[model samples]
Target: MGTKFGSVIHRADRGTFRAKYTYHGEVITKTFKDRLSAEAWLNGERSRVEADKAGITKWTSPTDRKRQEAAVKRRRTLFCDYVMDEFAPTWLNYATDGSELASGSKRKHREYLQHLTHSFFWKYPLTSITTEDINRWLADLDNFGGATPRKKTFQLLKAVYSKAVAEGAVAKSPVTMKAPAVPKSRQAQIPPATAEELQTIYANMPSTTRISVWLGAILDLRIGEVVSLQVQDWNPKTQTLRVCHSADVNGQLKSTKTATSNTTQPVPPQLGKLIDKACEDKRPTDFIVTCADGTHITPNRLRDHFNEAKTKARRPDLHFHTLRATSITAAVATGASLKDTMQWGRHADAATSIERYQRASGTERMREIANGIEDTLMGHEPTREELEAEIQKTKERLADLERQLDALK
Candidate 1:
């Protein structure tokens, strides 16, 4: 009872044991509730002494041990290495559907990520980088490619660091600043072409490519979405086009971009006639728009056709996507609500509809807004007396509002 297996067991304390040993030339003693713990402590102390004799200094203080671990981590992991070895494989390829990222998206990520790995920050410790370093990197991008490139590069780095934080690889992201500002003058401004200009382009396009232009301008269909449509996706009786699939960046056909993108859009009679002309004598599996040899039209060939049409129309600034912008702007100008525009354009948010899609409306459209207000006020003829009384009440309300504002001041 006095001693048991490298521990002292007291007779009075039957369940507990005392452990004593020499560590770093000092006698270290501790009491343990069990022989196993006491024996473990004794063994650890003996190992530490052996390690010290072997020229390996074992850390005795908690602070010293933490410092040494941090140094070792910094030595092993660099920002570039972490992104290439860990983040890219584990996080970048991850998706909700358990599939890899779209080919086009991966290409863009790789392009922008180079801005980080090729810069001075690549050798920085993964966990040691601070907000100031991120800011400096963003600021230096101006000499490289100006504001837009700078913003893209910053976003890529921020995404990587955010993944690091989420996985507990780093405590927080060093990228805390807002996006770089792109001046309106420096931005690549593509104004929406008018319906007349679009019609001119349509008239000059070949029969096969005309269908593509019509779909883009009228239905706001993306180039990939238009080319991916099969003859069966069209309902001739209802004049509705079901957008179920699209071509990916690599020119391979896939499902639509988002769930909201898979929609049944109404087709105008003119556009429906165009589709019928293109799909004549074609089977249900056949693409509605095809090349001269009856093969599926790729995006590269579609761009060449669009370029020819743009030149013939004498609107060199117009690209294929300009037709989509024109359609969205035209939709807004025709008194469509923001919600209706979002649904029609397959947009996930109204901000994109208002800020990006809905371009500057002309003076005539401004007058249309005034006309709408006039119609609302003049819906029914009001008696002269009633109208005068309504005007007096409005004046009184304005006066009351001014009085309340003055009181607050």
Candidate 2:
């Protein structure tokens, strides 16, 4: 007699059990020595079938498993140790010379790696880590910051594991889990400073940054674009400024943020004359906005200068970007169309100009609506011709009503 468990059969005469299951449209049979062993093997095969049906992964063939097993036997290095010696150098080279990532971005990724280095679980063998372990690590990063940082850290870890997989250090990556969504902040209206307030700040600023403030507030130039302005970019005859280049935080010259940003915009005559005066005795190669020694003014220097002037003017919240937003808001308030505002502000989209930069304070909007209702209630007297036409229409309506009343009587 033979004990049977679905397709698994234990043959008493042979003292062996045959376990069978369907794999890749073919029947696979394995022999075991005991009935319990046959049932256990059969259950595992059925589980693999269900997992494949659910689209998790295809069943691993015995040959493939043996090959992976051989590969795992050769992996002697732990993840932390391997990353420190081999992966770190490879990643640095890829991040710096072989990739398009910026220097600032590379620095941030390295900082996140330090967080991983502090975790004890990351010191384990790379091949031993499961997806559950990766998910738990992501949960641990929730204490670091908001969803954005958690997501970024997870992405960095994924990149590291992918590199490991490519280098044959591991069979596959265990970081297919998704991170939390980044929450969006509500946009707030930022009111522009008045002309008197701007003048006060401008007067108090140093000579090096005075022109910078003027260009930013009047022309609505980004802080990067303002600092990158050279003598040649300005044309006194046409009164147009060609915004083709900008400087990074490190004072490295690069193209504008977008193609639309590389435009020739008109400058007001007042600001044009100020630029002309500053350009006096300076060559085309010389930067129009620079330090006393004629070097390209870094973003840090510009921010420091602006902050001092802002504190003096009593507008502690004012920033260089605020000046740009203020200028765009003023232009829109004074009957500028959305298209025109977008062009002048160098916005790639109109929604950014209308929604983000435009300033209409809550109280100010309420006041305008209240004033409109009051003006409607306090009526104006009609002209004589308008009164006569209204009286004639009223008489005709009354006559029709009287005729209807007589017919009813």
All candidates: TM-score: 0.68, 0.52
Shift in Å, residue 37, candidate 1: 11
Which residue runs does candidate 1 get wrong by more than 4 Å?
1-42, 45-76, 95-99, 142-146, 183-188, 248-262, 348-351, 357-409
TM-score of 1: 0.68
lDDT of 1 by residue, 8-94 (tens): 444344666777654445555677887778777677766666776788975363345667787678556888888888766644544
Root-mean-square deviation per candidate: 13.4, 17.7
**C-alpha displacement of 405 in model 2, angstroms?**
72
CA error at residue 146 for candidate 2, angstroms: 4.1
What do the candidate models score in CA lDDT, each in turn? 0.75, 0.75
lDDT of 2 by residue, 151-221 (tens): 76676677778778887778788887776565543223345777777888889877867888878888888
Clash statistics: count for each candidate:
0, 0
